[model samples]
Target: FRLAHISDVHLGPLPGVTYRELASKRVVGYVNWQRNRRRHMHDAVIDTIVADLKASQPDHLAVTGDLVNLALDGEIEMARHWLETLGSPDDVSVVP
Candidate 1:
């Protein structure tokens, strides 16, 4: 059976904030990229990964934590969408 290992995708239309928001432009810039830019490399990467996963027809897929940037409440829905896309819980690892 084929198995796939995927981790830390951090897919987002709005990247999570950081403590350095008060100090780091890079961090803030990332948020802007995620929100305003409309298309990020990360988004493309995710599309490619999901497409590949579907095409590969892996028997199972493993998501090894940190799937999102900050695990914020708002991100849950997006995560669920991806999970649903991948397959059922039996096909992928359960969160809890």
Candidate 2:
């Protein structure tokens, strides 16, 4: 049986943030995202990986942590949607 392992998706198109949301550690994270992380991590790359994994028909998929950046509620929700698109929770084990 095939088992696929994926991690650190850092899924993005980060949700709109208000100044209030950037009040604490988020400020640091937001700056990092804006300055560096955003350019390197692309949704298209994740899509391509998902497509390839699906085509390979893995029997089980294991996803580790760091699925989202800043850990915002919206990011969690979006990651949930993205995970569903990849596979059911039963088929894909998620740790983040």
Give a tens-digit lDDT track for model 2, residues 1-96: 899988888998799988988888989988889998899877988889888888998999998879988888899899889888887778989887
Q: Write the per-residue lDDT of candidate 1 for residues 1-96, one digit (tens) a residue.
A: 998878767667654555654254555555655575446436787889878887888999887765555455556677778778778889998442
Clashing pairs in 1: none
Give the C-alpha lDDT of model 1: 0.68
TM-score against truth, every candidate: 0.66, 0.91
Which 10 successive residues of model 2 have the least lDDT summed?
Answer: 87-96
Q: What is the lDDT of candidate 2?
A: 0.87
Number of the top lDDT candidate: 2
